[model samples]
Structures are given as structure tokens and as C-alpha cells.
Target: MIEIKNLKKVYAGVTVVNVPHLEIKSGESIGLVGNNGAGKTTLFRMILDLIRPESGEVLSNGKNVSGAEEWKNYTASYLDEGFLIDYLTPEEYLYFIGGLHGRNKPQVDEYLASLTEFFNGEILKKGKYIRDLSKGNQCKVGVGACLLQRPQLLMLDEPFANIDPSTQFRLKNILKTENKNLGVTTIVSSHDLNHVTDVCERILLMEKGVIIKDIATSSSTLSELEEYFGVGQTTSTNTGIDNEENH
Candidate 1:
């Protein structure tokens, strides 16, 4: 479980993230939606203790995450390409991450073998470094490494961005399976509304650093979000894609 209490962040006199209270129960698949600068990544950073909030706190299983190390044992996140070691090959990167979590080479190999379809035969046995892979392929490597940890809490930002259509389909299945079978607390932020709605059981919409709407995933959820974003209108706003730079 995760809890946010009066969380706040500021930069150069402007508040980026502010939340009075929020709770994420275990085994929940949540989709965080917002235009760029809506504070999606800022909130995520606070959750992982990557950035210190100006006030309040984020708790993982009742333990404060800020300025603490214990939560790292059960948490994993992939915010961007910076999370990857650019010089290593995909195989090397996965092995290194698995090793950090006590999975030996044989164990890592076994796990990698199971992802052959996800890899699409391009990620493994390729002699190229991660930096050399296309952006979509690199995303695959990074996301794969995160799942290798089997973390209790998993977070991914803009996971569908730059990914091919086929791989995006595969990723949806992978995330749903992991959340359903392993009960991982999965939090994802995405600009792709359809994909996010397909995978997440709940949705949180943010604007100007605050959550304006929080709703369960239902038959009308996608259309509701589309209406809010003005999907078919000429004067459409934000679209949840333009605000990418702010996060």
C-alpha cells in the first residue's frame, strides 16, 4: 500500500505537485493521466524518494519513503532512459539488475527465456549496446529489467511512447498478467489513452499539479477522458502528450 499526505513540491516559486491525501491499495493497477506539467512524474519521484517534497510525505506500507532505504527492497521504477546503463548490452543489463536483487546468472537466464516472445528475438543475442537500440527497443530493455526484480511496487512512465504497435500489444498483456498473477501494485503514466484504459483498473486525472478527477475504470471512463481532453474538437487542449517535458 502507498499513502500520500499533504505532499507538495515547488520549483522557483511555483508549486508542481500538491496533494492533500491519496492512497493506493495493494494489487491495484492505476493509470495516472495529465497534460505535461500536471505533476505526474513529480508525484512519482516523491513516491520513490528520488526527489524530496517541500512538505508532507509518501509512505510505502506505512514506512516513510523519503530519506529512507528500506523501501527500495520492494520498489522498482523506470521513469526514463536515464535509468539504463547506456554502455551495456540488453543481456548484460538484465543480468546486472537481476544480480542486484540476488538472482544468479542461471536464474536470470531462466527468466529471460520466458520473455522470448516479448523480446521478439531482437533484444537478446544481439551484440549491440543498449544505447544502440532504437528508442522503443531500449524501452523494452528497461521495462524488462524492472519486471525482473519482481517488486511489490512497480512504476513506469510513458511506457507506450515510441513503442511499436505490436510491442505495445505485448506490453499490455505482460503488465496485466503481472498485476493479476503476482498482485504487484502497478502505477503507470501514459499519453496513450486507449492503452492506459485497457490496462489500468482505475484512473487519476491531473491538471496544474493537482488531481481534478479520480474514477474507476468502467465502460464510460475512456470516453469521459476523451471529452475532458477535447479529443475530437478543433481547440483540443493538452492531450496528455504535450506536457511530457514538464514531468
Candidate 2:
């Protein structure tokens, strides 16, 4: 389980994330939705201990994440290209990450085989470094590396962004399957209400750094989110980093 109590982050005295209390149980797939600057990325960074919180704490399965390394064993995240080793080829990068998780070359190879469709013939053996891949392809590598760890807790920020429409659908199915079969506790932040509602069992609405709504996935959930975001009247492409360009 993941726990948060009075968690907060500030930049120049302006609070970006402030959650009084929040709990995420095991095996739950959660989706976070909000406009740019709503604190989605900030909250994920704090949970991953990539950024130090100004107050309170984040607990992963009863282990405090801040200033600790124990939680990293069971947690994996892909927030941006910064997570990737830009100098290495896709194959090399995956093997390196797998080794850290105690997986050998053969094990990593088998796992990469399973993701062939996700790679869509562009990743493995491409003879290209991570920095050379297109933005969408780089997103694929980062996300694939995270899954290779088979973590207990997986966090992704705007994972669907930059990918083509077909791959987006594949990714949605893959994430849902991983969470269901592997019992991975997944947290994804996206602006696409349709995709988020389709994959997440729970949806969290954030505005100005506070969770304004939390509801189970249902026929009405998407509309509710659209209404809240005032997006029902307009078309929602849920397009790339544009969704959070300011963030």
C-alpha cells in the first residue's frame, strides 16, 4: 500500500502539491487528471523521492520513501526522457536496467520479445542510441524499461503522449493486463479522459494541487471529468506534452 499524510511541495513559497491524506491500496490502477500546473508531476516526483517534500511523508508498503533507498526495489517510474540513459542503444539500456533488478541477459531478452509489438519494429537492434529515437519511440523505451523491472509499484506521467494512435491503444491494453495479471499497483497521470477512464479502476481529479474528486470508473466517470475540465464542449485529442506544456 501507499500512504501520504500532509504531503506538500513548494516553489518560492507557492505550494504545488498539498495532500492532507491519501491512501492507495495494492493492485489498484489509478489515473490522475488535471490541467497544467495541477501538481500531478510534482506529486509523482515526491512519491518517487526524486524531489524532496517540504513536509509530511510518502510511505510505500510502510517504508518511508524520502531519504531512503529501500522503496526503490519495488517501485519504478518513467516521468520523462531524463529517466533514460541517452548515450546507450535501446537494447543496451534495457539490459542495464534489467541487471539492476537482478535479471540476466536471457531474461531481459525474453521480456523484450514480449514487447515486440510495443516496440513496433523500431527499438531493438535499431543500432541507435536512446537520444536518437523519435520522441514517441523514446517514450516506448522508457516505459518498456520500467516494465522490465516487474515492479510492485509503477508510476507513469503522460505515458500516452507522443505515441501514435495505434500504439496508444496497445499501451492501454498492456498496462491493464500488467496490473490485472501481475497485480502491479499502477499510477498514471494523463489528460486524456477517455484513455484514463478505460484503463484505470479509479480516477482522481486534481485542481490547484488538491484532489477535488475521486471516483470509481464507470460510464459516467468520463463525462464527469470532461465536465469538470470544461472539455465536454470541445474536442479532446489528449495530445502530447501539449497537455501539460506549462507543467
Estimate, for each residue in 1-247, the C-alpha lDDT of model 2 and write its tens digit: 8999999887767777889999999999999988777788888888988888899999988888876787898888998898999999999999999999899999999999999999999898979999999989999999999999988989999999889998999999899998999999999999788999999999998877889888999999987887867854343333232333343
lDDT of model 1 at residue 104? 99
The stretch of ten residues in a row with the least summed lDDT in candidate 2 is 236-245
For candidate 1, lDDT tens digit of each residue in 115-206?
Answer: 88888988998899999999888999989999899898899999899788988999999999989999999999997889999999999998
- The reply for model 1, stretches above 4 Å from the true place, is 231-247
List clashing residue pairs in candidate 2: none
- For each candidate in turn, the TM-score is 0.93, 0.93
What is each predicted model's overall lDDT from 0 to 1? 0.88, 0.88
